[model samples]
Target: MTAITAPMAHRTRLRLTARGRRLLTAVAALPAAIALAFAVVSGGAALATIDDGAPAQSFATVTVSAGDTLWSIAEDIAPTADPRDVVDAIVRLNALDGAQISAGQSLAIPAEYAP
Candidate 1:
């Protein structure tokens, strides 16, 4: 005589549907996406607050004369300094779209380099 017994199963397997897998993946990625966005925003704000440690620049107005070109004006204004830098500064301070200047136009000059 022989005894027969049914085999016992130790654990059940889990199978997820395609939709369930996609939903689970999205949920898992949501936290990472939020964290990345937060890092970018905070980094930008921190960068905005960082100072270059340079002093504030001051400006003075100069009226252009009949023979005053940017080069001549910059040279007269800052003889010992670089004329190119002075001219660039003048252009920026006055917000001139081009190098063209009329005789009566007033231009802003950096105070440190002003005559």
Candidate 2:
């Protein structure tokens, strides 16, 4: 013969009050707030020191004239160096968008190619 069992009682759902919900939100946000604070504090120092009085290297500036191109300018400035290499150096040093340069615009030549 099998024994009879009693039915289980229903449990009520846990309801959070306003204060409890605010405390829960604060707890969840605590770590993120602390991380942001640490980042702001620790990032406020100089990672490396460099002497600001004297520059390590200086660049020579060239003024682009009418009818002048990078190839011609590079040839004129650095006669001993290859015009293509000089042009490439000038483009990179001046942060040019392309080989296109306008008249009267100033460009910085790399020290190696500077006259």
Candidate 3:
């Protein structure tokens, strides 16, 4: 009797419609889900730190004037950072490819990129 009722219910059910809405929602949530999963997998095991209400850091923004070289900019941003290391940090910070940079741009000055 159960088998007969199950088959009848399956056959009588109307096919649910509308794939576009569901697909749109899934696509929108993909990036957030990926970020959450990455954070959880990467840092979930970390232990607690002592609570401190210190003011958050305010990062400085340096504008690139005309004819400003990357080396000069990097040096100014990271004075103590090694030149080679600063170059790598600049590339990563400015999101550059092949040491490319244009004038009249702005970039964040990272304190350090540890070895």
Candidate 4:
């Protein structure tokens, strides 16, 4: 019988090559580049919404009288404009909880609708 000899096992080691290192670097930088691009795009879009030629709007004061309602006030102030829009603006300007108003109360009206 011939003598049998055991073969030595070769050990394998993991090493990152130049191509692998470059790929890893690119992957790490991808999110930062995307975030920068998104910020720039959103900033530009926000700046575009501003209108330089539009006139500045102003407000005026109105004293609430007996039997006065928001709908009636809006119509009287801005008959040419939309009553619903005017009422909404009045509500927002006064920071009122509802359309309820009392006598001797002061309210702010848009200058365009002021008499």
lDDT of all predictions? 0.84, 0.83, 0.64, 0.85
- Estimate, for each residue in 3-109, the C-alpha lDDT of model 3 and write its tens digit: 54434544566564579678878999999998788768867333211243212342345777888777877676666877677777666755677565668787655
Per-candidate TM equals: 0.51, 0.52, 0.45, 0.50
Q: Number of the top candidate by TM-score?
A: 2
Give the per-residue Cα lDDT of candidate 2 at 66.
96
Off by over 4 Å in 4: 1-57
Candidate 3: residue pairs that collide: none
**Candidate that beats the other on TM-score, 2 or 4, i.e. the better one:** 2
lDDT of 4 by residue, 1-115 (tens): 9999999999999999999999999999999998779769897554444544222456788999999999999999988999999999999877899989999999988776787
**lDDT for predicted candidate 4 compared with the true structure:** 0.85
Tens digits of lDDT, candidate 1, 21-99: 9999999999989877976989855444455422345677789999889999999989999999999998887778878
Candidate 3, overall lDDT? Answer: 0.64
**Can you write out model 2's per-residue Cα lDDT over 1-115, one digit (the tens) per residue?**
9999999999999999999999999999999898778767877333222234223465778899999999999999999988999998888777788999999999887777777
Q: How big is the positional error of residue 53 in model 1, measured in Å on the Cα after superposition?
A: 19
* Model 2 TM-score, 2 decimals: 0.52
| 10: Cα error in model 3, Å | 35
How far is each candidate from the true structure, as Cα RMSD in Å? 12.3, 9.8, 12.3, 8.7
- Alpha-carbon deviation at 112 in model 4, angstroms: 2.6
TM-score, prediction 4: 0.50
